[model samples]
Target: MNWIDELTSTLGDSIHCDEACLLAHAGDKWFASHLPDAVLLASTTEQISEAMRIASKYNVPVTARGAGVGYVGGCVPSRGGLVISLAPMTRIIELNPADGIARVEAGCLTADIQDAAAELGWFYPPDPASRKESSIGGNIATNAGGPRCLKYGVTRNYVLGLTVVLADGRIVRCGGRTHKNKQGFDLVGLFCGSEGMLGIITEATLRIIPTPPARAAIQAFFPDFALAAKAVQDILQAGHLPAAMEITDAFTLEAARKHLGADAMPAGMQGHIIVEIDGQERAIKEELPSIMSILQSCGSINAMSATEPEDIERIWQLRREFSASLRATGLTKLNEDIVIPRSALVELVDFCSQLQQTHDIPIACFGHSGDGNIHSNIMIPLDAKGNERRAEAEALVHELFAWVLARGGSITGEHGIGIAKAPWFEGAIGSNAFELHQQIKSALDPLGILNPDKMGL
Candidate 1:
């Protein structure tokens, strides 16, 4: 029997090889696209296990996917095979405030969980920008982070347990609902950022904390990025740890000005910072001024504070527009989420500036400055015929990653080493570490059916 016939007979109605399903699961936000041989609209862990068993038996490659909202082409089925989609499995099994735990299916939306937790006076603080559209399974797969990660940490930190289906169709449960456990190897963590290679995540037990009563935010612009970065150090050194802090450079600000209108960005402002703090009403009310004072001392321009929720969100709305503004400039934006030591924020921007000047390419830098995961965008202008300089842009990306490595930084901070970064994965991790990775991959996925050809494995 053909592979499609076998999958259909074993998996029943859950298997689909229709053009619509194949096209839907083709790729993610990245520019790459490839049609899978079949798409499995998985609705249960049992279904996924059986599907995997069939794939393993047939030696068919498998790629686990969720939401299809990843920035990297993590879900793209590079090799035509079965694409197991978890989107149909959406379910919040349980939310227990007494236990401080949320049990959810893999396909649950990140923002939905956040809203449910907020209603219960609890918080799920991963807050990836794509939370509204990204799935919990994808977040766990990538170990995603966001603006609030500086204080609350990433998706991996909140993941207390997981239900994973191995390549041979064996279902294994790791960790538990408890906030802390050291029973054995951190197997739960092993899969948290595994990028769907080791196994497929079907459900999760996540830790949740009580929500803070009040929060306030401050928006400040500086004469230069150096002063803005310095203010971040000063705020942390002053014993005030804000929940979220973001910084932007001049090029991004210029794009915003041109796109959002010149009045959107103040004149002579080369840097922008947004700092937010959450706690009891009185404490946050008092903390805002202290942060503002530091901003002013750092030579801030048009410093503004927002204590109301709507007002704070308004500031964030504009902050979120940085990416849109860059896109509006009609340049091809290649966003690289790189990380360096917190102290190197200014230096990283300076390096990007040098690259811009040397190659005549515009690079925009902005993001979670408190931690060092800045979204450095290399904007490539289209030629007269409206074709992007993709080759030149890729070479520039190579140079940028090397520079990041030289500075003791990572090529990717939140997005996993998906197909987009596969070329640099082995080199970035070095030979010894790369071998270890291969050993782990071999041990768990002997057939190499799960996420084949990814991360250069």
Candidate 2:
């Protein structure tokens, strides 16, 4: 029988081979696109197991898809096979406050879970910028980290258990609901950031924390980038660990002003740093003043504080618009989330300035400066000199990656090694480590049917 017939017979209407479905499952937020042969909209673990069984029997590649909101093209089905979508499986199974755990299907939206937990006076702290649209499964796949990760940690820190489906259609459970589990091995960690090369995640049990009483934020504007970077160090050195800390460069500030109007950003600000503190009301009240004073001491031109939740969100709203502002400048933003030591923050910004000047490209820098994971964007006008500009941009990215690796930095911070960064995977991990990764991939997916072209595996 044909592959479609096999899938259809096994999964029945759960399988969709239509053009629209194929096109929909083809790509993600990234630029690349490639249509899969069929799309399987499985709503249950059994359906996914059956679909995988058929695909394995025919040796057809099966790429698992989440919300398709990933920035690194991690969910793009590079091979023309079946795209197994978990979006239809979204369900919040349980939210036990006493147990401090939430059991949910892989397709559940991150923001939805956060909201659910909030309703019960609990907090799920991994707040990626794409949380509103990104799926929990997608978050786990990339082991996503957000601005708050500097304090609360990433997605892996909260994942207590996972139900995974293997390449050959076998089902397995790793970890458990308990807070601590020292079972056979750390399989949960292995699959969390495996980038779908090992197996497909069906469901997850995540750990949640009690909600803090109050929160406040300060937006500090600096005369230059160096002082802004210094403020970050000063804040940490003063024994203050804010929930989130962010930094933005002059290019991004100007872009925000142009795109969001003159009042969108503070006047004449060359550098900006946002620090947020959350906890008891009295403690936050005591902390905000000290942080503001540190900012002023570090050559801050202006400092603003937000105490109310609405006011804090308003400040963050402006920060979140940085990406859109860059796009409004009519340039293709090649966002690279490279990370370095905290000491290298100022040097990285200086090097970016030099790189932009050398290549005559408009580069915008911003992101979680507290943890050294900055989103360095190289904006290229694709409409003008498309081919030549594209080539130059590629060369610039290579240079940036090499410079970062040489300085004990990583090419990617939160975004996984999807097809976009696969070219640098082996070099980033080294030959010995790459071979070990390959061995694990072979052991889990012998047919190489799961996300075959990703992570250079």
Steric overlap count per candidate: 0, 0
Which candidate leads the pack in lDDT? Answer: 1
Provide the global lDDT of candidate 2 against the true structure.
Answer: 0.91
Candidate 2 residues lying further than 4 Å off, grouped into runs, are 382-388
Worst 10 residues of 1 by lDDT: 261-270
For candidate 1, write residues 169-204 as lDDT tens digits.
Answer: 999999999988999999999998899999999999
> Candidate 1 — which residues are off by over 4 angstroms?
none
TM-score, candidate number 2: 0.98
- Residue pairs with backbone atoms closer than 3 Å in model 2 (clashes): none
Q: Root-mean-square deviation of each candidate, in angstroms?
A: 0.9, 1.2
lDDT, model 2, position 257: 88
Cα RMSD of predicted structure 1: 0.9
> TM-scores of all models?
0.99, 0.98
